[model samples]
Target: MPKRFQSVEARKLIQVSLKTNDLREARLLTGKMRADLHSEWEGRLNGSASPAAYPPDHLDMTLEATEAAYSRIRPKLENLAKQQELDNQQAYDAYLRKLRNTRDDFLRAKACKPLSVWSDLADRRISKNNWILPQGSEGYDTFVDMIAEAAIEAFNIEIARREGQFAAEPSSLVVKAGLKAKDDTAKDGETILDLFDRYAAQRLAEGRKREDGITQDRKVIDSFAKFVGPRKSIKGLTPADIRDWRDTLAALPPTYQKAKAYEGLSMRQAAAKAKAIGAKTISPVTVNKHLSTLSPFLGWCVTNAYADRNPCDGLFFGIVKGKNPRPPFSKGQLEKIFASSLFTGFLREGQEHKPGIQRADDWRYWIPIVCLFTGARVGEIAQLRIEDIQLDDGIPFLLIRHDESTGQRTKSGASRVCPIHSELKRIGFLSFVERQRSRANGKATCQLFPELEPNERGHIGAKPSRFWRDYLKRIGVKSGNDGLGAHSFRHTMADALRTAGYLDDEIEVALGHNQKTVTAGYGRVRQGTVKRINTMLEAITHSYISFSK
Candidate 1:
């Protein structure tokens, strides 16, 4: 034979719990697992030995398990009846009542327990109420009742007896199911464990509030399951799989009205309650969200020592690079930029702003206002909490942050607090805060402009793009370029500041860009620079209300 290559030992070394009876089977599973990968096991042969290795409780039984249990206890019940025959019939009846009471309590306690946990369904029963007297003369007769207080405690001890064996071998769950039993309950599809792990870590790292978002993650996972091969693993997600998912999601455009989402989703709805934006094409922002969700899952495995490397590090979006990433806004398009930002939306029937240019509690105006003044991303502005704001000496400021795979890590791996204006503060911001406090306990979020709709529950809906587009058209503005939106706020605000004589360093601080340098070091807020940030804010918010000659 040619030179032999020493194969790496694929057998994983593990500690077997003394509680398990299938140590030999577990070892065999380890040997087979040694082949090409070291990962989570899927099918039952892996460590979780099948019932074939051991017999199950009620290995053969009828569907009416409760009735079957009652029937089995009937003989013992009759023997007790015979022993009590000579006693006062009423006393015998009283004794039976106590037994029945004890039995009812046992059923009540164990009903919630999984059937597998109880191999013998004899645990469930109940009896009718009754009264009885002792066998002695009526004057000396003792009262007997159904109060089985001490007996219930004893019955509980007996119920605990099965746990030692049943917990050791859970194989009874499938075996008892008979023909209905499955080899495994986990479906053949992609899962989101790693995805949530990574994104959760990013949120924590960025110091952002972390909430478990199972619904959204499930939407992506269940849809991906149908298209992926059987028994698919998330770790084995292929580029083609991502490409197909993206194309499919792209084909099914979201609708303009959020209400339309309630009708139903499709055979492969990857996004939950994802309403279509009125725009004809999917914007770069929207596409990036899909990537953000999928890529981080792969990243989670790498950071957690699960994988040697992140598979997402090299994966590119789309065949066309420019098609995926959005370019930063440029100069010379200030008015069009403002117009796009001011978009009011399509003139749909009975669906326009309610007799006012803006919704009463809308974030559309405030969000753009923040962008116009601070040049920060929409997401950064959107995630602001009232507590996160700092104000002192007639000034308001924001703690600019980027929630990454972990919530705690701010952008640039650092947080910078930026200032705000007296005028902007005057624009009902505090009144909005008071309103939030009243509804704090009952809303998606108290102390934020984007209050969660009670009906939608935990979902966060974006401000409508229609109102912005229409408002922009009303303001005589057009995008200088074909593809652009609220992001233009950064470019417009930057240019306006440059014209007002702020240097590039000042502009970078205003935008909270992730640049490292001596000036950026000073980007840290000084004790009294709220005045400076306020000055910067006053510089931008002056002309939003339109003027006429």
Candidate 2:
């Protein structure tokens, strides 16, 4: 076994018998066995051993599946050859040169690090299928091998065709014509779902979308695909189809996707069930969210010539906004929240509601206060590193930015510097920062709230948000999803700033909202800008509740 294979668990190892007495046959069998072991070990090392982590398509390692995967990309190879033949002599020579360069690059990459090359091809397949594959799984490795084989076969065929010799059997003219006809048909014969996958991949690759956002958009699009029949082509999409989907979405119950009652049922079927049960359906706002995702997707399809026009155009004009918008925390609610056991006193770490002498200075204690003053989102505050707190020309400010290495992301992909409010400084926020720094002991990358771990979606704030919601209920300030929770603190800050006579742009800058005007991107937030924001923050007053209490 290789040194790499040593890391694999002993339980995963298998013993095989050649089951032959002949020496020559035994040698051949042993060699084949060795190769198989190596492939399996490589697959395990690459992280493909877990079947649960991959999509269903990835699990299929059959020869037929491999051939089908190859067939999907064969048209592009054939089209390249056809184009070279039609071009002028100079253009033809250029085409050959390009192919030679491409082949050389491919060969070099394969020879140096073959798995990476194979993995790249496998990624393309996964992207086309709209499935995410864990980089190193047995299934992914299998697909990589299959794709590599297909790609090699394709290169060989191209090489032979270039040499004016048909080394392998060629497709019949009838078959070729049928394939060409298929390609000529609607968007290279790709389904609406297929085009959506491509659009999603492009968006993700361009950093235009986040993984969480992509996951959400995928859910909406997948539901839409199911509603319209997954096999439906992009060209066949009509305004009527979109309207029908919107109507169906409005009729379905909230969280119908995860509800046990609606499990294994189609969208129409679930909606029908919801209607029969007289259950409360999703709001117009929720319906619009689905449309919002689809509208841009369809727009992309149209831009790419997959469709004639976006069917979702002007569809949102009909959706009336929901009446129950999230409102800011009331003055009385703020009083009760600050006076809660978590702040004044708590029995212990976990039991935050019970009255006791213990006053915890953790996320539960500080996150809300930081949000109340800075107007930063709960997630933003929750993900703050010790280094994020800094002083700019005697003005202490928070550097709110997306750090990909730390998995901290801003909502708008834009970073902002927000001056620490005077109230927070007066109440010992800076002292808290120093204490955290002391605890970190010069570790610049240490998180301010290290106790808060990221959830499955890589959101550090999710658990804290849940804790806030539960705390709100315990303190009788909120009940259920009554549109009042941690976010209300941000809303409260915005309202307070507005009441303090701050301009909209100034408040937006303080709150880290993505600037819409071109001039907003002129320069970095300087010391003067930080001072102005600090002055604006100081203007905010809550006379009803005293922090000194």
Candidate 3:
């Protein structure tokens, strides 16, 4: 016995038979027994096995806790309400309101005679393997309110039964507690996958989440379910289960999910294969992203009564400080990039670096320049329409927006206008727009860069991003996995804005980022705001690169 368990159990010695004659088999059985005993002893020490030592007010407001609390005192409350024999529906309604007030007062003051009754019930439940709410926690208050609400609902159902309004068996209060109703069960029962599907459907119906995001979330959830067990009930999930999954993901290759050799293999198998081949595992940031998806899903499960608590909470890999994964292009690298064959002279559109007389005025020639100036995403630049370019109050700016009908979408899901830089106009960008508009022949839906097309994932930047990578390598500006790409331009722009003494909010507005501060959301963007941003955009200047050819 270990020293930690000496005081845990009063017994000086505990014994269990291995029931094996073979030495190796006996050792394996003994190991399993030791693990089980350790788990049980730890649970006892943590108050999970005996509620007398349970900490107060720490349990989150989960459906299991709320339901347990409600079930404890519901029958007594119902009998009290029936004994009152309220004469009319108005009196019953008033009684319901009174119960609601008591609940609210208990939450605010954390004291009342009614709370004493609940506290007693909580003590009884502690011995019955149920969780107790810790006082002074938000979960404690929410738990009290939910139980009070359930009591009132029970009274209402009793009133209906007395008045002959309901004939069948009384419905469970779990539905009112935000759990799925008994009758709402799916065909084979609600698995983890079913809950995730419900979550995805609700988010998609609300239009707040994008399909691409949903797809990524689904992949993570699916992998987790498979890692644990495909048919495992969500209610059985524990923090240890989530921790094991996180550790496994950190060990596997970054491309294990999509790599051909790793396909159709279990997570552990793929991890072992990766270890054998000396393949690098996933970074902390990527592992954290997986946890981010699971955290919200588990939170939703708690709300919907699929789980007791979010097991994914606080389970994340620690990222190194001050080590940026993606770095901006250096000044020398930027100079080399703009002075390359694509910017100066190229053979033709496809063979830009081969050195020919053809001046490429297509997407190949314009998107990079536009991204460098606007700090806009490559996808945003690729999906622009001819009508997106307009003169507002005599100032030329590009309207970066989302239009579902036109297959154009912004990362933030909202729209912002970016003022065209003066250098672009000096280099005949407006003339290029005129030529595109003339080619459109009055078609409002015509794309600004008509040659660029969306890929299978509906992202127009896919091809352009690939081209930029190849171009950077061909121009000797970057090498494999050095993190320099089209997105580097946005980082460069942000650095330039910060260097010019612009505030983060102003730069965020210029780059179409969703503002984080409450004050930034107070005002609507009017013409004055646009002009102010335009003035801020004018501050970006590159002294090394000249507009003149």
True-structure RMSD for candidate 3? 21.5
Q: Show pairs that collide, candidate 2.
A: 46-136, 47-136, 47-137, 48-136, 48-137, 48-138
lDDT of 1 by residue, 379-437 (tens): 56666656656666756577664444323233344566677655556665656555665
True-vs-predicted CA distance for residue 445, candidate 1, Å: 12
| Prediction 1 TM-score vs. true | 0.42
Specify the highest-lDDT model's number. Answer: 2
Q: Cα miss at 228, model 2 (Å)? A: 1.8
TM-score of each: 0.42, 0.64, 0.63
Candidate 3, residue 7: CA error in Å? 71
Using lDDT as the yardstick, the better of models 1 and 3 is: 3
Clashes of each: 44, 6, 6
* All-Cα superposition RMSD per candidate: 22.6, 16.2, 21.5
Give the clashing pairs for model 3.
56-134, 57-133, 57-134, 57-135, 346-356, 347-356
* Model 2 TM-score on a 0 to 1 scale: 0.64
Model 2 Cα lDDT, one tens digit per residue, 1-549: 567788875645566776656554455446646786788877788887543343645223333234443455566777877866545777767776776676676666545655465676667656655555566777666566555555555565566676577656324332333334344334443776667656766776668887677777888888788777666677777899999998888899988888999999988999999999999988887788889999999999889987889989877746445654668998889998887788888898778988888888788888989888888899999988999998899999998878776788899786677889878888898888889989999786899998989887788999989999888898889987688878888888899989988877777877877788877668875323777778888888776776742
Task: Give all candidates' CA lDDT scores.
Answer: 0.46, 0.75, 0.74
